[model samples]
Target: MEMEKTTDPTSFHGAYRMTPATFDELLALVGPHIVKQTTNFRDPVGVSERLGITLRYLATDMSQRDVARHFCVGRATVCKIIQEVCQAIWEVGAPLFMAKPTTEDWKKIAEEFNNQWNFPHCLGAVDGKHIHIQKPALSGSLYFNYKRTFSTILMGVADAAYRFIYLDVGSYGREHDGSVFAQSTFGKALEDGTLLLPQSPNGDLPYVFVGDEAFPLKPQLMRPYPGKNLSDKKKIFNYRLSRARRVVENAFGIMVSKWRILRQPIIAKPEKVDKIVKAIGVLHNFMREKEGLEVECDVGSESGMTDVQIRLGANMYSGAAWDIRENFANHFSSPQGSLPYQNDIVQRGLNI
Candidate 1:
């Protein structure tokens, strides 16, 4: 005989795949928005239950069918609940967690970069991730990536601490990182100087985002020198810049680790999967703040110097952007800003 459905929250939370405290905290945050009007003794599945249902699916990579079986709801009901609760979570969580900070906040981030990563005048790090998903019907090769898998792009900016500052998700995976970034609104904002970035401490420097070679170099952006034939100063500069970019790498790792749904190929339509990915991003910040949860990605933080980021060769800009990069590179090798190891590396003539 089949066993009766358990109603105990302690047991439910174990199945929910997060701590009881975190589950309760999440329910309290978004329960009002997702709460259903029709609930009684026979229909005990309320807002909190549906919230738990959705969170369980996210945390465990469980299918909607499995979630429905566990939650004692129909598959259609489960699907509706997931979308509804996800929307609620984004509405309640985005402004608080994903919203851009003030100039003062940016200053703190730059200060952290100076203290921790030894990269000064840095604002944030940018990177792109491919969210794997099943191919949609009648949509031939639209989502096929170079890796021969289907996915959507999740391009994001993270600060020194791996907190997401901006995100643009749901782009077709066929587009390369450079093109995706070029088309992103954040990239446009950076180019247009519409973002209120924190001013340099001494006012002579421009605050900038650190990215891999996948991104084009700009006055407000920094990328390492191309080619294996590099100098010690170039090596040191590359290392310093890579170290700063680790925050975004770690953030993605922690996110995928915690929300295992992203680990496997998500099975859903692109429209629904978009909502799921976005909700995951928002909830990542929520769970991170509430639980102080940060687990590094199993593969470790990537330097992005690999072949994937090395494409879209050699772009020349007709302006001072190139000059600014030269200035930073020169300053990195100068006595005023050069680190001891940097000098040692230069002295040893080692290429990093």
Candidate 2:
């Protein structure tokens, strides 16, 4: 028995098979009925098998040749299969994931921020993160960012419930958050007031968005004051702001974790990166909805309160009157004072 360790060719092939969940999700998106069947000598392979092979490759990080060899097809066939599957996933799931938040939705989000994070009169948190991508064949320098790394910008706005309202991709890796945002459609909407903020009982409660210190401070944009003399009020404000802002980080975590494809270096050309980014976002939304984890926000019909009433309520709390800046200064100067820990840092550090 010790001398006879035989390997079966079929056993090696079985290990490359796609999981049932992956196969079913793909078939559900692109029906098995419509998938082309192999027949003629010119036909490379069966659509179902090609799709399965593509899933296996993406899910396992296997090379194209590995997938091709497993499916007994050429590497070109594997490439085509990946493109087709990616396109299919995008077409079937895009609408399900990237929905525009309604007025009522915004209202609900505002409530969550106020209740959960103590950040009042906020509709959503906005920020940008980098997703590494293979360098473009034609314009390598365009996508490079200040970090000196090659990555595509993933700019998104998320509600307190962690639901993404808007997302943008395709920016060159070289752009900074502010620079990339300035050129984005969402940014333009914000500047033009087309993307209206929710009206609170306190005269639109002066809707504010939270971001990191890298972004400039403005009436609409709130960042922590960097100084000594950190007072209790400022510390509380920063703590609450950090809490609500973490939804975006959680969203990104779920995305990369579920789709390990994002964990590895994206080897596709820059031109195809947009599709890849969109496909992942769409998939993220779809999965969230399917799992019934989608957070519902009430943007309007505060059925609960009228806009004027909400504005009046917000006016009652003069956040500025709390001397937030003084509090911030005190906290930074204290030996024991510290910034809130971001989930991305805590979790990612552990993983590394």
Candidate 3:
């Protein structure tokens, strides 16, 4: 309470990662569910306080005990409050922030990819990252990843605006992106052709999601051509695809940069961590949408450009998928579809 009274607006945002107005808006939405009944025994914690505690925990690496101290509450109470409030936030915010896109929505996303990323007919960018966690009890190697960390995988699809179109959490970290994606509900829908996507006019080329070498190349999914000795046209296609696909990477970057809880290893069970991760993802979309955030990709070392490679045999990608990729590659180098700066970027990549 003293801190609240004394802290300036910048300090408040640094603490909670949102403006007072935004906090009030969020409190109004999730307040009812988290509000406690005033019993004769004692008055319960206020809704604003409950939400504030949770936000501070997420925005920083503070432990529940530390958060409890900061909020003048018991550690056990802080734990319960964080869990309950996170669940309430997800329940209230997920539908609005993470709603599955319709055909029209997909079309708009593709249009944005074309306009902003210069990658036409691109629906979204897909990738997965390992989220570190404590090793679960009696679980041998289930959560252990190649990075030798006990973690879970967070697979996401981000549109050109860097908003997550879909998120799948809680996959075992031992699994790679491709395997996790292949097993995901969203991936299954895409494979089954049941996922809502905008129809192509000619019916020859379908809208595609740009991924990296870690993912399989499909008619619906486009990946960079594997190998160093690529032609200028293929290099241009790669540069364009990487430009678009980097949105997901930057989305993750912004999310982790803003919500520092994800940067440290979460000390919780896998089930609890799943809720926390989902809550964070939902909150990420909410903040990005409400804030009108910019999508900025890193201009760092080109070495950071390529994603983790898991060897996918050439035979795994169908001929039709190859043809689609070729078409995109050719178009990216053509006068009608080429960008003025694409060649320069491709050359820089090659020199690097």
TM-score leader: 3
lDDT tens string, model 1, 55-167?
78987868989988876789998899888888888888889898877788888888888888888889899888888888988878878878788888889888776678888
lDDT of 3 by residue, 1-352 (tens): 2125224877888898887888888988998899888898877888889989989999898998899998888998988888899898888889999998999999999999999988888999999888888899999999887767788888999988778889998888787778888899999999898888878884445799988888988999999987888888988888888889888988887788778888778888998888888898898899987875633322221211123326456237899999999988888888998989878878887421
By lDDT, rank the candidates, best first.
3, 1, 2
Lowest lDDT 10-residue stretch of candidate 1: 301-310
lDDT of 2 by residue, 1-352 (tens): 0011116533322342223453456466665533655566666455567556655665456777887786677888677767776677677765556766667776777888777665666777877777776666777588665556577777877776566777888776666666666689987877787765676565423566776554545556666644446545455555556766777666666565455556665777765666666766765666665553423322211121001001111222235623443343344334443335433333333211
Off by over 4 Å in 3: 1-7, 294-315, 350-352
Ranking by TM-score: 3, 1, 2
Taking all chains together, each candidate's TM-score versus the true structure is: 0.88, 0.69, 0.92
Q: Kindly state the number of residue pairs that clash in model 3.
A: 0
lDDT (CA) per prediction: 0.76, 0.59, 0.83
